[model samples]
Target: MTPPAPSDENLLPAPVLVVEDDPLMRQRLALVLDGLGYAREAITFSQSLGEARAYASNNPLAMALVDLGLPDGNGIELIEELRAQDPSLLILVISAWSTEESILGALRAGATGYVLKERDDLEVSLSIRSVLRGGAPIDPFIARRILALLPVAADHIEPEEPPRPVEAGVLSARESEILELVSQGLTNREIAEQLVISRYTAECHIKRIYRKLAVSSRTRAVNEARQRGLLP
Candidate 1:
């Protein structure tokens, strides 16, 4: 018997892997991927950690949507393993668990985006797109929840006042400009476009900013800047 050829959409992009335990949710997610213009063959669905691990070992996935609660083991373990294997993988957590612990743990485990299954499919697709573009896509509600859990006193403590005008030499004018845009939540691509620079140049600036500030992650970089009175 002859099998039908893969669709045009499948040929347009790299594969996206879905590691979910629920059969229905798996199908729903596949549908979401389809809505994002990915063909069936471009989406690989796994119902357990073992299957996902095997597939990941053999395939180079462009992105992965993982569920935390798996039949074999917690999905965090799989996320950590995958991250250990490939640090550049864009892993998003799509689970019903939205507790602070689950969200924070997923980020710590190298998942770039933590999306709850309750969110509509459109939001999920948007989050996938955001992660693909190197933008961190944290759900607004989840962001609030995480913020509420932070120590309130930290916000009340005012650090020593920095010098007025924050010496231009503190960070190169271009680096400071890039940091400001970063604090505004702009992705490298958006920053590049706004600054009329290439994405690679913007990314290079961000890396230098991270190294100079001795911080990683945009959130931390922003916080460091505020502490130093570089931003208002």
Candidate 2:
């Protein structure tokens, strides 16, 4: 007889580490991992970088969800150490710090994904899932902020002329409406509610807007739209 195949939950990577200082945030992350089919016993939670490092030294981790502001030190240092220990390890930074330095530093240290703590649980869940799927999920706000710093960083270079306005027909009417709501900082869920559509529908419209504007993040889409005079 053929042996029974393992379920998806049983096949999930084990010995996951979550390095976070806040008690509430730790609990929230624990719940998120649990909902994602990770066994409670397979998950380890540490509140400081020191504890996390000690644990990492002893155990081979498959994945880590790290926070930037640890009680003992910055999470960036830990990320560097973890990456050095296991190049294949999946590390996702779930941090409150959003400065350009923080964002760039974490990425340079080999974090596979960077998600802001301010994001709701749904957003965080999606990011974790993306990591599991071998995708790097960056926060749109972080992406936008990083893009804003590029021109300033290249101050010595001559500035190029302003972007030419795209044709008014570039975006469909519904896409324009969705982009406007996005500029207002609405989440996909909020946009769906406002437009009386499914969250998936709202997300699809936003993706179309991204394609039309040639921007990958929501902030960049809005900035591009403004530059092209698609939105006032």
Best lDDT among the predictions, by candidate number: 2
- Candidate 1: residue 65 lDDT (0-100): 92
TM-score of each: 0.60, 0.62
Clash pairs of candidate 2? none
- How many residue pairs clash in model 2? 0
Q: Model 1 lDDT vs. the true structure?
A: 0.76
For model 1 the local lDDT of residue 136 reads: 86
The local lDDT score (0 to 100) that residue 44 gets in candidate 2 is 85
Tell me how many residue pairs clash in candidate 1.
Answer: 0
Across residues 80-171, which tens digit of lDDT does each residue of candidate 2 receive?
89987666678999999998889988987889999999998878888888888799999999989878877886764455444233333387
Per-residue C-alpha lDDT of model 1 across residues 1-232, encoded as one tens digit per residue:
1122235532323567899989988887877776666657557789899999998775556678999999998899998888775566679998898876788778777888888889887787788767766888998888888788678636754554332232222667788888999999999889989998656457656755676677888998889989998877
Off by over 4 Å in 2: 1-7, 152-232
